[model samples]
Target: MPNIVEPKLISGNANLPLAKAVARRMSMHRGMSVGLVDARVERFNDAEIFVEVYENVRGEDMFIIQPTSRPANDNLMELLIIADALRRSSAARITAVIPYFGYARQDRRTKARTPISAKLVANLIHEAGIERVLTMDLHAAQIQGFFDIPVDNLYAAPIYALDILHHFKDVSDVMVVSPDVGGVTRARELATRINAPLAIVDKRRERAGEVAEMTVIGDVTGKRCIIVDDICDTAGTLCKAAEVLMSKGATEVHAYTTHGVLSGPAVERVSNSVLKSLVITDSIEPTAEIKACPNIRIVPTAPMFAQAILNIWNGTSVSSLFERETLGPIYEGMYSAA
Candidate 1:
């Protein structure tokens, strides 16, 4: 209930650059002393994770910025171990800032005897003494209910919209296409932001991680198209969807996704596909192959995360960050960040 004298940010080995970038953005605000905690999250000889915090965090507001991305198991363990360390140190409030929540795709049971791993992960975090969670663009919104604590699921739609507008000055010919029926809502939200028409690609997936059939439900003839989705792992769907749209007479195709989980041959697929460009936020650290791809572009989410952190720390409204007029200034001339 007392004012925070200083905000402590500690990160794991997942995404140190993003953590540092958020720290830099936080420093721009007055009266907020944001710095990295003097801690070490190292691995032992047996591949076991060990965390040691050297600073005194008693009664201080602490945030652990660790995205559970690739090597999900190790990174996830680091977050849990770090939170436990902070709790034992008697921190006033500990928030787990996970940009990408691993195992999120398994939010529900798909078949008999299947495990709902997302909920299990949520329970693990809850049991680890974290009071809240800060993540972005969850695979399923209902995953928030899996946790008893407050969960802030931020969206990258505003950031994507800003970058979309910057690239395309004329929105009259732009069409937003959802690669599948499930993503229509997310695609429509971006469509509304950019004032573009919406379309849907009906696809059938006979097996996991593979699309068997795809049908364009709307006319994309001669219009510049943009496919919207939350994650792009393997990129088989996006690459195929782009081909389908172009075959239907779309002049050009582009894609915007939140987490660029370009695992396996996703980078190669995007590079060789018909998509003119693929824009993604830095929710997950980019791979070397992804960085080398000319068609792939990355936008920073540090400023947005910084503002949300400040709001939450000050007990203000976090939803207002998505308002149209307010987004321009936050992302103005923000092609890249530290």
Candidate 2:
């Protein structure tokens, strides 16, 4: 950490813990004295949002940190209003530091004559006065191109790889598995770095919330399998993939997902599944049930995120940050690293 001109940081109600962690790693304590606008979001009789920023934000380098996770509409609107408030108050520059960008998966229209909402979200953020955008593991990398503003898409691969190495003494038998075909590239890169094998879960989506589990692509029998998915919404797919591998004679099964958007019944499914455990990054806030689950775990991405933020703030190269790896035991009280 070098001495640089610190910008005034501000956070919304989306995921304050993550924002605070980022601030702490950067050696800045939030809510010390700076007046922050209180986002009083309410719903009128018609169920429309009414947002207002309570404090002044005149002439400051404002960074609005909101993830737009569950209840995405509310969180997204909150960010828009916050940025609008800053703009009206004449903030020097506004940067939207979203830890998790919602609606990224809808980057393209899989069907005919449908809207590309991801691009629309990008447009809305820009119109809301965002000069730049910073987020992690967008569902589709191409979403970066959709925004004209300077955008940085950070990767959690290095952090995940390092964790895998430290967790298993000999990762030679560990198989980095992609839950579906699209994630093969990501899975392959991780497997190559750890010098481990790779596997793929051939699945057929019969319909929404229904996945038809096909055979495992590579040899995972009697080997440790680590399923990789960008985001685990219901935990159904990952859980089923893990079970399939285990049934196929896999020794153990673990999941490393970047964004843990565990919606309804996700925590319950993971708890009852045959998977040994799950290793997830704190990209989104986990529910109480998700935390209480025996097999579910969380790894903080604060240090990696902090370093990237610092690099951005200081005008340094952050591309090389992807070269590093994160390794450690995912088990609670076993080992922790970023």
Candidate 1: list runs displaced more than 4 Å: 1-3, 31-33, 335-338
Give the candidate number with the greatest TM-score.
Answer: 1
lDDT of 2 by residue, 132-155 (tens): 888888888899999989998777
Q: What clash pairs does model 1 have?
A: none
Query: What is the per-residue lDDT of model 1 for residues 1-338, given as tens digits with 9 covering 90 to 100?
Result: 45667768899999999999999889876445677899999999999999999998898889999999999999999999999999998999999999999999999998999999999999999999999999999999999999999999889998888787777877899999998898888999999998999999999999998899999998999899999999999999899999999999999999999999999989989999999999998889887788889999998988888888878888898888887567667766663320
Displacement of the residue 203 alpha carbon in candidate 1, Å: 0.7
Whole-model lDDT per candidate:
0.90, 0.79
Candidate 2 RMSD to the real structure: 4.1
Query: 243 in model 2: Cα distance from truth in Å?
Result: 1.6
TM-score of each: 0.97, 0.88
